[model samples]
Target: MRAAERELMARLPEGALMQRAAAGLAAACAELMGRVYGRRVVLLVGSGDNGGDALYAGARLARRGAGVTAVLLSPERTHPGGLAALRRAGGRALATRQKEDAAAVERAIRSADLVVDGIVGIGGKGGLRPDAAPLAELAEASRAAVVAVDLPSGVEADTGEVRGAAIRADLTVTFGTHKPGLLIDPAREYAGSVRLVDIGLSLPDEAEAEALQHADVAALLPVPGAESDKYRRGVVGIAAGSSRYPGAAVLAVAGALRGGAGAVRYVGPAGDAVIARFPETLVSDQGPKRAGRVQAWVVGPGAGDDAQSVAEVLAQDVPVLVDADGLRLADRDLVRARKAPTLMTPHAGEAAALLGVSRGSVEAARLHSVRELAERYGATVLLKGSTTLVASPGGGPVRVNATGTSWLATAGSGDVLSGLAGSLLAAGLSALDAGSVAAYLHGLAGRFAADGAPMGAHDVSESIRSAWRDVMS
Candidate 1:
């Protein structure tokens, strides 16, 4: 982003980019207000260009007959030109350097209809400072809508880490492009809805992070050709479930059935249960080695105490997806030694176990944790949570899935994801593609199944077809 900004600034006249950014921000704010003529707008001014943007935007609102107030955090360092512009347009400014001024800022914030958080930009780190923390709290307490400039104050732009008090904006109007924090959670939760304003800056072809959309997933999904047959499509092997949890086997198979696989081969102790629920499954109790030929293998879901079977599947030449109990039992060295593609699906707790970190650490730094796991395991890692992330070894942008609901937190959902991704892998997609696409479909299915109500894992599995069709349509 800095590179793009520098290039654009070199070609344009001084202050031109700032003017464009302010104009775009003002327009978005106007739309949010419905009518800005008589609304009260407050600008939380800082010591940088972010404050300049807010100040100028406040000037625009003031000119349109809105009551505008600028609460300056650093009176000495505030943008001179922007402050001058706001003053010329009849916008009042108050400093936080004095105790009386601070009190007045709080009163102004509580009564305002709109509060623009320009206190900190993307460059600011470690949350709000002591002097500015109270204002952020006041903004949240206010009934007014909060709009952030560039990004919400105190959010780590590149990592999505919120260390301390951060501004919670009802809407964030960012300049140039979307920052990584706006897409991932922890910080994403604070940035309510995002509006990107183009400032004619050319971004790189590949971003550090990416979110998949319907069109992108639709294009990636496999479609059968005229000559395609069950064998031509691909067969996926399932080494999952035990007597204690045969439901995992059923749910996994359910997801595999809708994952574009030609057929599913089931192996392990739950053969009778598998055949009972899904008669079409080619069942065998002989284990992964004896389960007929398969293009890919999905091991682990509910394979309790089946370390030998997990090891056997890892030795196969085809792509393998490891999940649930398999993640715990599989050998790290054996996983790293595999020449074939390996995709590990682990929730925060499992991920923490794999990395020797606390679950809290994994949840707090999801982006970092997923990438580290991928590199250490020398395979693709799908870290599942609020914002599911798929990271591949050798480093590139991690694919983020933003379609899921809290309802997906139900049991057996991860098993379904495992089978679905494994099926995609068998059908000729790369490990990364299979994992990301499966997460996308799984999240959508969860939403469809739940729809603001309680939904079971079976419902999510059954809704996969509908989710797929929704994407295709």
Candidate 2:
């Protein structure tokens, strides 16, 4: 589902999709309430199909002997059929006829047992209006477990932006496919844990995906065969690091060693330093072309704007990771015509340069920007930040690194990510697989290394083995 958004809505009727959504939502409520016998189910209803879905689901719960109530925000514009259905099923429907203030709504919301927020969905624009703002505040402050209908209300379904205020849900029962807002952050902050309900609405072919699951990540990893030796697995060449920045190369190689590889080959002025730190790495003083056969190349971590060296590495016939300076030196045609896979690991800034857009633009719409980069360069792209997203040009599951700790953002952290991913590429995993798995494993390692304390890049690299051990068990 990676096609354009407008095209996705073309296949289904809006009304039919709503009914299917309500049905799925009712089923989830039944499961959550266990037997649904005399349990209080409160729906903070709004003036949209999202609220309609909630009211209809409340009707179903009332039918099953549960006590359900819908607190409508817009009484005049409530879903007509939904009101009738709730009454028939022995559910009570109430409107905020008192004060139309945020404080009054917050009080009602705080008193709920299982609160259903039908405030906003994919069609919403901006933040919560004052009338509905207090309800969101109450949901956050209360002991009630909020189960949002469609998506957490007040979240931008297209972009992941949370404007003024948003409902923070313990569980969001989203209709149809996952919206981009639920997957991307800022808004992702409000959505506690996302759960999907398959209604019949056809998600657009261009629907962006996020966070690859562990089983998928495991499949992406390169496991060695019995006959494979160090030479046969694959050799990865690194042209990162300079006299000015020697530590970046060290961290990259440290990560590379953990990436399932036959061998790692290091070439550049940092040879002495890299060898001194990682004695296992095969260091060479020769040029990239003369550095011998390699299955993959990891370039640009600390390599400055040496145009000739960057071009030489790009000219090679292996999978390449263009990062830092490598992104600046890249020729569009050269990238497209490359003999093997290409993976670009750029933070928001680098992606902005490649797309000729502002850094804020990339950060604001990371999912879209990463996919655009992949399609533009015909490569896999990993956009690193709070939610590390890996998007492939081939339209696969986009992986988000949820395992990362805040401490993982230290200097040279990204350098470590590159080396680890490059090693996986050398070991024969596809670009998407290698990049996503690296992000996952790297985050896990970071958490292990840091525990609760702040850490340097070396500590994160050192934690790789322990994290791997835990995974094996």
TM-score of every candidate: 0.98, 0.82
TM-score of 1: 0.98
Q: Mind giving the per-residue lDDT tens digits that candidate 2 earns over 195-282?
A: 7876544554653566666676665666779998887888888888988988888988998898888888998889989988889999
Top candidate (lDDT): 1
Alpha-carbon runs more than 4 Å astray in model 1: none
lDDT of candidate 1 over 346-448, digit per residue (tens): 9999999999999999988889999999999999999999999999999999998889999999999998999999999999999999999999999999999
Compared with the true structure, all predictions reach lDDT values of 0.93, 0.81
Model 1's alpha-carbon lDDT is 0.93
**lDDT: worst 10-residue window of model 1:** 98-107
Q: Which residue pairs in model 1 clash with each other?
A: none
